[model samples]
Target: MDRTRTRTRYFTPSEVAAHNTTSDLWVSFLGKVFDLSPLVACFQGDPLLLPITECAGSDISSWFDPRTRDIRRFVDPQTNCIRYYTPRGRFIHTPPSGPRSDWDNDVGEPWWRNLQYQVGLLSEKTRWIRIVNTLTSQEQLQEVCSEETMEEILQRYLCYNSHARSYTWKFDGAILDMSATLMENGVPDDDQELDQLGLDRDTFIPAVLLHFNDDLTEG
Candidate 1:
């Protein structure tokens, strides 16, 4: 079953960049080539609440090495700044080990919060693309995995700004306040006001769970 040896084909540097597409693009192509990529399902929430722009201007010198694969920075036709992609996996600091008295409240952390935020903004619609490559430098993405390094990454995130040509009240506010509001109020509740807005209470809370799912469900 190790396709890497049998069916796997290798791409040279030019090939990787010449036709390399986002992850989503690979999924469609993978089924035709390997028949292994599945249709990754997710909830209909705000997919990219936090953009990778936050990671810009951070001390990612260590993560930028070729070994860890923690940090990836690039400038393409999409967002103009450096796009940092890290190998972030989900972790459960707390478990829903107890009874499901309030299953809604028991939602866990989401594995893709940081990346989702970035992808969400980049992709206009609710869906985005994901591409996988063995040649993807490990050192580039490694910065997101370490706790100490992640803290540093977040600090830089707090300073990120979207140079949107349009005006909006949301971006004008402080990042901490915006993130806090999203944490406390972004989730939809049964409350009359939130219900009218079509938001769900459990929607945003589980983003903290970090490992339950890849794509988020609608909140």
Candidate 2:
């Protein structure tokens, strides 16, 4: 385990997709998500950036070579030489088909190689949960990365209930361990199982009832 990645944030595909746009672009490749909005702003009107814009808020793993972890390359039959196989046309960081004297060689690291642009890891799995406030009778359905713990899930619920921490979280009448993940709390994600059984996973989102603790300590 890479201890450096112990607290890595995880995002669902839809969450990434929501950032689609030239002003707020996000894309994932090789399981890592990148915010390319800055790149878009840098190359604002460049036509070569179309391929990236076309795939904003989506995964572009196919654009890279698995082993190389770089743009896919192939022998260009016309040139009889290795070349970046950008059928969508060469985008940012891609060298010209043939070198030109004007091509700036000091562009620094490519966007993919620049770790500063890396936002988070794309979630391998996501699950939906229904959070109900026992005091207010308000319910909010939330989709969260399965990698998130109950404590993190509470943060998501905060958008619906501001004083979320004032509530005692429970499932099936048992208090939950805020530090534990859903599975650690014995919550099973059966989306695939439901699909295999011809049932809609959306129809069976498990509910976590929040019982308000009359802790006047919270303002």
Best candidate, TM-score: 2
Residue runs of model 2 more than 4 Å from their true location after superposition: 1-6, 215-219
Global Cα lDDT for candidate 2 = 0.87
The C-alpha lDDT values of all candidates are 0.25, 0.87
Lowest lDDT 10-residue stretch of candidate 1: 120-129
The RMSD of every model to the true structure, in order and in angstroms, is: 26.5, 3.7
Per lDDT, the best of the predicted structures is 2
**TM-score attained by model 2:** 0.90
Number of clashes in model 1? 41
